[model samples]
Target: MDSRGLIIGMIILLQTTVGILGNFFLLSHYLILYYHECSLKTTDLILKHLTMANTLIILSKGVSHIMTAFGLKEFISEIGCRFSLYVQRVGRSMSIGSTCILSVFQAITISPRSSDWKGLKTKAPKYIGLFLSLCWILYLIVNIIFPIYLLNKKVKSQNMTKAKSFEYCSPGDRDGIMDSLYMALFVFPEVLFSVLILWSNGFMVVILYRHKKQVQHIHSTNVSFRASPESRASCTILILVSFFLTFYTLSSILNACIAFLNSPSWWLVNINNIISMCFPSFGTLVLMNNAPTFSRFCFIWIRNKKSPNFKVAM
Candidate 1:
């Protein structure tokens, strides 16, 4: 109820609102396309998964933060804490994994015909469903550790040296074996996917550069050095991956600091939560802007509404 708390609540409220609207719009747009077209492109499928994951993440974290900010943490029972944390972790992992897959898929799709990865371009679309299923299973197994140690306990007036799973939950039990297992299962996959995203991004950049050189040499006048659709898609994926990495890294570092501090600031914890929520919140808008079809529709809709006499050219 203090000024700082109010400010944080307002910020989270804004993020939650924007995130819900953007993600809902993106998801609904794709659903309409899939329903009418009777099938989805590979990228569209991946995007649908990403939007679902992002929406869950926003709801889980955003609502929890708002409740805490408003001094209504009691509503989150022990079961609620366990379920919300588990869902949040799963959603976070899915966001990372799906984005990584999307990047790699684009890399393969845009690979040179002579490249080894070129063969996957035709077969990748067939396996997207399987890949997404596996991702959910993997993350679910990893986060099953949540409810084991998460307890709904009141926050006592005591200095803490580490972070708890939730504001209303007790500090996580100190089991070295469980801690190591969690790291291996949770952290390992995140690091692996992040590395894959970076590698795929680099490969796509190199391929695009070489292709541009070839196109220029073949016809300096006939071909303009404009970004191809593949290049634009790759760039958008790269931006998304970069943003996720930045936000995740910052939140991780802050969490680490909080773990070591003898007296962790509550505001710092709120800030970390806010940072964790940023990727899902703003990343949807990035996807909307980068999507040509959606962007065109939005442009035409807005322009026509604003100027009744104006017409958009196809």
Candidate 2:
């Protein structure tokens, strides 16, 4: 491999390794919790789904790029290409949908006692399964086109026509009508989810601000301003949403450029793949930082081994 290829391969390997480990730890922690309690909180259920999706995203995207970078693209067959792309797209859609649901659920959970949506807090858990089921169904339906059109064909040159193809797979046959329909179906749901997430987070922020003001009014002297669990959860979800959006938007822009450019740079393709997996890799660590149980477990173990008197501030 050339220097550029070697560097890209190393980066992909690093990202895949770290992402898999972080997500595996998260999944294991929750599985243990679920086994002991025999029930999952609504948020926990959403998180479990998100972790699973993130793992698939990392695996599908990472393995493809690694294979390309290492000149092993010939190992992937047409079926493999179809399956990988299908799974990647489905996982991506699920991540977006699950995050939106999580944000909305947290907003409802933390709504003021007299707020219009407060009643949802009591009933939301019952519908989590339904919502997740719908998410899977919706994404599966929208992305079924992948397997129909994707082929394992080698590209001889890096030209505009082949820029949309993966290293081991040819770009799927594109019809104007089908492309328009696909874009409409995909964009509509994504835009709707984005708006919902933004609205939910915005509402929670307002609630937190008002609560802070009320607390200040109630205790004029020496008031502790510790964040509540709800507030912390809201903040974490907001951060996750923000990161996902940023990465997704950048990837979309790069993809659009690649589509239009007569000769897209090979490095741009590598960068796009790297950006695509960033959220799944780093977002898992972000989540771990906010998970009280996981954080506490790590702290206690580290403390016992290093300093007996060490305390976790959170």
Best by TM-score: 2
Cα lDDT computed for each candidate against the true fold:
0.80, 0.80
lDDT of 1 by residue, 50-131 (tens): 9899998998888988888777878977677778878888888899888888888988898888878766878898999898
Per-residue error (Å), model 1, residue 82: 1.1
Q: Each candidate: RMSD to true structure?
A: 4.3, 4.7
lDDT tens string, model 2, 163-206? Answer: 45454453544557656766787777888988898898788889
Give lDDT: candidate 1, residue 7: 89
The lDDT, on a scale of 0 to 1, for candidate 1 is 0.80
Error of 2 at 305 (Å): 16
